[model samples]
Target: MTDPETFIRSTTRMLPVPGVPEIAVYTADEATALWEKTEEQLGQTGLPPPFWAFPWAGGQALARYILAHPQIVQGRTVLDLAAGSGLVAIAAAKAGAAAVWANDIDPFARTAIAVNAAANGVAVGLLPGDIVGTAGTWDVVLAGDISYERDMATRLTGWLESLARDGAEVLVGDPGRSYLARDRLELVASYDVPVPRALEDADSKRSSVWRFRAA
Candidate 1:
């Protein structure tokens, strides 16, 4: 197996994210080339898309919110669900969270999180594999760009709502993804998140940070 961390570092450049410049990430300049490289080197035909290779609109919005409102995570435990590239997790840790956990089932994503967190000079705990139905040990649960897929969104919404019922502040960063259940959430913040044109319809998206309310 290819050393995912090493491969990521070699294939990508450490670029400062557009809105969140406090941290840097190893990102592919072009998505197609990266995808082809992954296939050629890894020989893995059926792998999850490399969500870690770029800063998504939702994650960027969430990170900006956390930086602007540090008190939300200060001295608290934060879990960034489906933590692609560890952007929001790093932001929470930077904003003074007592502990920040970045969770992603993909091996590449986990490796990317570790590398990105280290690059940002933050200590983010790694949650390997799925933690969808786990205990509500986190003071804040953040999900960014997770509602793009149907099956995962179904599981995610139910689990996040459970955490909300347990009194943990649950926030979801979304860019009007097809699967987001808007009725279950209330908006807390919105941002015009800059994103790659290939990944979004426009140069930026009007993403929002939505709080999950009790049922």
Candidate 2:
């Protein structure tokens, strides 16, 4: 068997995007088990828990949106919540956000964010902990693929609503998850994302991006 650490390090290297200038993203695919091993290695330092790495479809949609509409983030302070691989955060920085904060519960995720940011040649502030304690308001709050579970969806939606009430723009990207609250969300854009066979009910599934505004 391949050494898990080496496998993860090799698989997660910088990825280039076609036709997107100064834009690239890090993705965790089937080899995510290797990433888990990296997290174990990080445990020796007594740092925060490593954020779980997933397919990152939500982040991809958010990144595509930012690239298509650069004006949304230009000169604004942005927050990327549950930023798994820092794809949304990196996109915001590249789109000219004045500053970008990438928050996640996983320490390994924070490290990956740092590496991806540097690879993309943008600066991102890594917030390694729950989002509750993070201070300061932002012009925009971006989230991706966070509504898989009902309880988590409810709590996250509540928090996003709170941020919206405070005048912060809250946007979420999802692939039509069952737990998503359709009533409170608006369809900003949709894409036919390629869902891996392992993640989909069938061979592949197409996902959509839904944006939520405070109601």
Candidate 3:
């Protein structure tokens, strides 16, 4: 496999995140070209797309909300669950979170998060492996753009609800994804987040930050 750091650095460019310009991240200009390059480098077909290469609409909205309402994470331990590119985690750190942990199952995401956190001058702890069922003591738990798949959404909804019941402030950012359990969450904030046409059907998405309610 190609070195993830080297591939990212060579294939992507550091750019300010749209809708959340306070922080910048490595981003790919063209989705199809990057996807093809990634497959070629990894010598695999049908690989998952590089989610870390772009700030999704939901992540942009979440980061914007966290920066605007720093008190939510200020002096608290935070977990950016399934963090893509560590956008939300970096935002939490920038907003004064005592500690920030960015968890993702993807190895490339881990490398991207590390590179992004350093570029933004923030210290974000990168946690690898699956973290969904693990018990956590973080004061706030954040998830962004994770409801795109049905099975994943179902599993995470229950987990997030459990976290909320355990007294963690569980929050999710979504752009009305079909699988999102909206009935189980309370809306905290919403924003018109700019998104790339290559990844989304529209130029912008009406994304919302939601607080998961305890079951």
Residue runs of model 2 more than 4 Å from their true location after superposition: 1-11, 17-22, 26-29, 35-55, 133-136, 201-205
How many backbone clashes does every candidate have?
A: 0, 3, 0
For candidate 1, list the clashing residue pairs, or say none: none
- What is candidate 1's lDDT per residue for 1-215, written digit by digit as tens? 56888899888999999978887999889887888888878886766678999999999999999999999999999999999899999999999999999999977889999999998899999988788888879999988999998998999999999999999999999999999989999999998978999878689999999999976
- lDDT, residue 145, candidate 3: 93
Using lDDT as the measure, name the better of candidate 1 and candidate 2: 1
Q: Write the per-residue lDDT of candidate 2 for residues 1-215, one digit (tens) a residue.
A: 44533443565545553223356655455544554555465554444323334445566677778877889889999999998778789888989999999998765577777877887889999887777634448998998888888988888887887787778888887777788777887888876554445445544344555666665
- Candidate 1 lowest-lDDT run of ten: 40-49
Considering every candidate listed, which one attains the maximal TM-score?
A: 3
The models' CA-based lDDT, in order, is 0.91, 0.70, 0.94
TM-scores, all candidates, are 0.97, 0.81, 0.98
Q: What is the lDDT ranking, best to worst?
A: 3, 1, 2
At residue 59, candidate 1 shows an lDDT of 93
Let me know the TM-score candidate 2 reaches against the reference structure.
0.81
Question: Judged by lDDT, which candidate is best?
Answer: 3
**Model 3 — TM-score against the truth?**
0.98
